[model samples]
Target: MAESKPKFLILGGLGFIGRNLVKHLIDQNAASKIRVADKAIPETAFLSDHFMQYIQHPSVERIQCNLSNPMQCTRAFKDDHFDYVVNLAAETKYGQDDTVYKQHIFDLAVNVGRNVEEHKPLKFIHVSTAQIYDADKKPAKETSKVKPWTKLALYHKQAEDELKKMSIPLIIIRPAIVYGPADTSGLTPRFICAAVYKHLGEKMKFLWSADLKMHTVHVRDVCGAILHLCLRGNPGEVYNLADKTDTDQGKINDFLGILFRIETGFVGSAMSTMAKLNMKSTVEGVNDKHCQPWSEMCKAASITNTPLSPFLPQELLYNTPLSVDGTKIEGTGFVYQHPMMTPVLVKEVVDGYILQGMFPQPKDYPRPTPIPPPSFETK
Candidate 1:
């Protein structure tokens, strides 16, 4: 008899990466059944109809539960045996209190890990952040020093440590600034900021040096890596899921400049130092500048409510670099379909929101180059 396709469980499946992963599995026809367990439902997730069809596919199942609670975590898994369980659930917000981070991040991950250990899936993939690495000039390897820059990263590191001790076949993936369609954090905020500048018809300026690393990986590549690592990667190993972009602030701004048709620049060291001294005020000022214009654009477009926002937290505004080495995953024979950060790719993200009516598509801006349909044909 022929073997059955793998049974998959995606925790936090309503999230950006999780939803994309579900799409990947369905597109590839890789899973016999996919169970999506998350705190939110499809209606509230702000998922595009393009993705809604995939989530509501005949092979996919939806479950609602908070993974932070142990009872709900157990309920999330149920009695069924899943072949692959990917944990994408966590408090992704920045600038939260220690207790919020503790309960939602560390506590949630431990609860999920304990449940995973009990069920013992074939492969348990935990999505982590690359922010745990020390901010340095060089790219951080998986074995790099664990000096978390933000409170969010601090708990991620702690969760990683605890999950490491579990007897389950666990594989950890730390991605650098995951961006693409349905992204609120990551590059979307910067895109919105550039849009604000476009409306103002002014050059966009950043606080830090142009060279500050803000390494990025597309969400498609992130989803691709998760599946690749699940099948071929060794259990009990950690992998970094960065692209070959070598993306820094300058590269990102350059792409944004071309996409938004706005000039981009950075403040010099002296001004940046002053801004650093009063970071709270600086961050507030920047956010204030962007939010008003963003709201105006939404109003002009007749959009009542949108999940997208230009408001950036102070933690995200800091100069800390998220440099990471994606070559390790390449060594495993997994290729990044979207290797570089390009203007077209950035435009693609904006275009997705525009199509969803979540973002204003300015009539004054120049027409964008025609983009081909999303493809992972590189592999």
Candidate 2:
């Protein structure tokens, strides 16, 4: 049996998800101790006094190290001898070239896995991405067919394969577009873009068509899922941690417009097509290969019984036949606390970014959806 409150070492512990996990673990008292490391933690104003409070303590240690460098990676594992090691470190961009991604980032995933195997921890948790699922489907589960092409998808897939081959007892979690307070990557920018557009009172058109799907989850919820898997998930198994609802691009846009009080319009089809038609590699001259720096127009939307909106970008929804079946995790007694709705997440992320001052304010930032009181979203 696993020791109660195992000591944890989190290699990618300072990135968006890593930070959330550390915060959550502290608040919940989920671990005996946590050692966090990353290439370099970017300094941001978004970190609050509360965040600073938690950053340094007897219970945690933060380090600057690159995992792709095997010597640095091996030294961490040998020095710590931790009970659980979560590899949340990855170059999580969707619009970058193959060479840039593999060299600087993705190989880091394999490196972490190798170190975990060498260290022989009680459990190794690999936080991966759901991009591996073929965009042709929506709400894809662990059983979903794998697609090998997407740059984002391949990175995690390769990591999983390499780790499994090494016989590491791992818990792999693939989450969709994640957003919430303190987010430095992914959908936060779209909110910044939308918020600034709202402030400017400028009419902005979405790059993707109305029907595309953009699955999302709150950063806190993703943290919860990771904690749950660490506490109770089956090793050598994979799970998809995403919004309960399979939300689409059109719905996300309409909701955000309503919440922010902006008149929103959408462009149709994939931005890739838009780029192709324009004879460029990207819309707005942004390279699709390095999609990590910003959010991308993902696949088409999936229909779901759960209604998640009132603030999501509708045009951003592309249909993804992927549907994540979380029954196994549910069976393991895992529970999700957040509503997994777009508006709810959008509110948290947008407000958090504004508070951080990282998001630039536009003169006409639109305030369409009247800010809901904290009690409004009460489940």
Candidate 3:
């Protein structure tokens, strides 16, 4: 007789990482039944056709509920005994009010954590961010100084601290700038900016030094690590999930240049420092140039609607390095599928949106071939 597939419960299942995780489980045949609990439904999530097909897979069970509400969160876990419960729900937007973070992120995570204690899954995985560390030249370890540069990171750190007090079997994963399909917040903005610059026929320049540390990891690796840790990680352990690449702003720009066929550079620190002194004006100046031209490009292509945009919130526009060390997770015998970011991989992100008709097709950019999901390593 074969072993029964592990049952899974995924909180925030329709989110960027949530949807991707569900797809990963289905592709690997890793789960018997995946109950996806989230506030938003699939039809309203603006998922691509490629991702939509996977979310609607036979093994997935979608349940729409507000995890922020304590009653709903408790009921979400009472439905079945799960082998693994991964929490991917949170307020991901930057530059929001403190109240917003309190209600949606810090409060909601606590609510879910309390309920997880009652249900008692084999492993309760909590997704955190690399931003909890202070921006520095050195990569941060799990035990690094807790000086979060962003408000979102502050709340995540708060939640991490709170969740530690509980008796739940917890495994925390902190990932560096996660980039891939269904990524609206991470590197997608820069991709949109590159396309905008291509349309304007100008060199794309950025604030801060080109060598600023901007570590990254692919979404596939994130999902793989989550599953790997679910089976093999120690309770009360925290892991940093990043790739081998020591990616910097310049490295990312080089790939963007290749994809958009445009020139890219950074304003020297002298000018960038001045810009930072007056960040509000600087942010408005940057967003002002991209928004109108992007609209014009979409209009020319007859694309009346798209989720893609070149807007960067003030918090993200700040000159803070997000360097993170990923070597720790490797000690657990898990390997990254995309150990490094490449020009082709960066181009693949833009091409994916283009294929989905969410992004304006670049001139001379060939149609993208369907990318096969690489075999996930659970061992």
Counting only residues 3 or more apart in sequence or on different chains, how many pairs clash (N, Cα, C under 3 Å) in candidate 3? 0
TM-score of predicted structure 1: 0.95
Query: Candidate 2's error at 373, in angstroms?
Result: 19
- TM-score per model over all chains: 0.95, 0.80, 0.96
lDDT of 2 at 188: 58
lDDT of each: 0.88, 0.64, 0.88
lDDT of 3 by residue, 108-214 (tens): 89998998888888999999999999888899998898898999999999999999999999999999999987888999999999999888889999999788889
Off by over 4 Å in 3: 1-3, 371-379
Candidate numbers, best lDDT first, in rank order: 1, 3, 2
**Ten-residue stretch with the least lDDT total in model 1:** 370-379
lDDT of 2 at 122: 79
Alpha-carbon lDDT of model 3 = 0.88
Question: Global lDDT for candidate 2?
Answer: 0.64
Give the per-residue lDDT digits (tens) of candidate 1, residues 67-96: 999999999889689989999988888878
Candidate 1: C-alpha RMSD after superposition? 3.0
How far in Å is the alpha carbon of 280 misplaced in model 3? 0.7
